[model samples]
Target: MPYLTTADGAEIFYKDWGTGQPIIFSHGWPLNSDAWDVEMKLAADNGFRAIAHDRRGHGRSTSTYTGNDMDTYAADLAALVDALNLTDIILVGHSTGGGEVVRFAAQHGAGRVVKIATAGAVPPVMVKSDTNPEGTPIEVFDSIRAGVLADRSQFYQDLSAQFFGTNREGSTISQGQRDQFWRQGMQVGLAAAYDCVKAFSETDFTEDLKALDVPIFIAQGADDQIVPIDDAAMKSINLVKNGTLKVYPGAPHGIAGSYQQELDKDLLEFWLS
Candidate 1:
């Protein structure tokens, strides 16, 4: 039970394994660090130090009613990095975790980070606006907020299907996978989960992406249902100074589970490169 207390008094639980160049993992919304077990194991087995934190208000961390926004999320992450005294780090994030990583790199990750990788990540921006016409509409996020308030348990269970693309024809996603997703989502605090919807959807990362000087690897599912590739990774690649884009054909938003092997191969290459 490794925990770090942030400036805002939120306790963040983290997992640290193996010992080499550090690879820190940030998970998506409504899910904990357990979501990164497979990848963390891979990184550890490959002679890298694997680290992942249950974001504040999610999983085993303190579920504070306040500071559920992206800025706080980044600050919590900075606290973890500082506590560990890690350098030359490889930061990997999935979905909302992607947003956290981007913001952290822009704000707190000056000389500490060496490389970054994001899969099924939400970045650049997710919500629609005049400047970003391809983004998802605000109504969609409002519906998500409504769903969270009305019946969150059922909402998470239903969202697991879309997150993994199990609702699609010929999809190979398993029942257990969907069940794990639901389980993870259910562990999130109601307040954090609710506020995070607005955080992930509305926070613009255009400037954050532009601030990165390290090599960035952006992986996206061609058929992501939650965060569309067109609005996220595709556009994110152009914003970073050094960026590589890898799109998984017919992959879903939960590429970490649905397309694990493919993502592992690509990430390994990027990390070693």
Candidate 2:
């Protein structure tokens, strides 16, 4: 139940376990540090310190209505890292958290971070624009906003099916996974969560990806429905000076949960190598 107060006076709830090189986790949109439970345990058991923080508006953090954009999100992450005085960290982000990590690295991570890894992350950009033609259409995100404004609870519940790939043919999501996602979604502040949709979808990470000096590890699912590999991971790999790509065949957007074993193995290998 530890918390860190940001420069903006927002309290961020975080998890810190074990004692070794820190593997800091940033979770996706509308979810909290709880989403990284499996990865945190795995990293800790494997002889590393594991850390995860709820974003400014999600989980146990201060549910403020303002400062829900990428700049604020990245700044909040920077504040957490600074307050902890942690170094030699391996930053790992999933989905929207991926965007947060990259932005943090580009804007603040420099000397503190050793490497970076993202899975099914939203980077380079997720929403289509003049430059990002392959990105998901803006209308898709707009529709999401509409859904959130109309019926957020039902919207979050229904989105979990696709988010976890349960809606796919022959795919089955465990009740536990569904329940966890729903619970996390429901706990998020309505205004902050709604604002985060644009933060994750519209914020471009091209410069962030290009500015990264540390070795980059990109883990993505080939058939990811939420953030397609082609527009995201693929383009991201080419942008980084030192980058490696690993594609999980048929895996979904929630790879950290659905494909935890595979991701943990790969991440451990990268950390050791």
What is the lDDT of every predicted structure here? 0.92, 0.89
Off by over 4 Å in 2: 256-258
lDDT of 2 at 72: 94
> Which candidate leads the pack in TM-score?
1
Per-residue alpha-carbon lDDT of candidate 1 for residues 1-273, written as tens digits (9 for 90 to 100): 889988878889999999999999999988999999988998999999999999988999998899999999999999889899999999999999999999999999999999999998889999999998999999999999999899999999999889989889988888898888889888889999999999999999999999999999999889899999999998999999999899999899895454888899888888778
Give all candidate RMSDs, comma-separated.
Answer: 0.9, 1.2
Error of 2 at 140 (Å): 0.7
Q: What TM-score does candidate 1 get on C-alpha atoms?
A: 0.98
User: What residue pairs clash in candidate 1, if any at all?
Assistant: none
Per residue, candidate 2 scores C-alpha lDDT tens digits across 1-273 of 899988778999999999899999999987899999888898899999999999999999999989999999899888888888989989999999999999999989888888999999999899888888888998998898898789988898898888888887867668788778889988889888889999999999999999999999999988788998899999999999999999988788885454777888998899877
Pick the lDDT winner. Answer: 1
Error of 1 at 192 (Å): 0.2
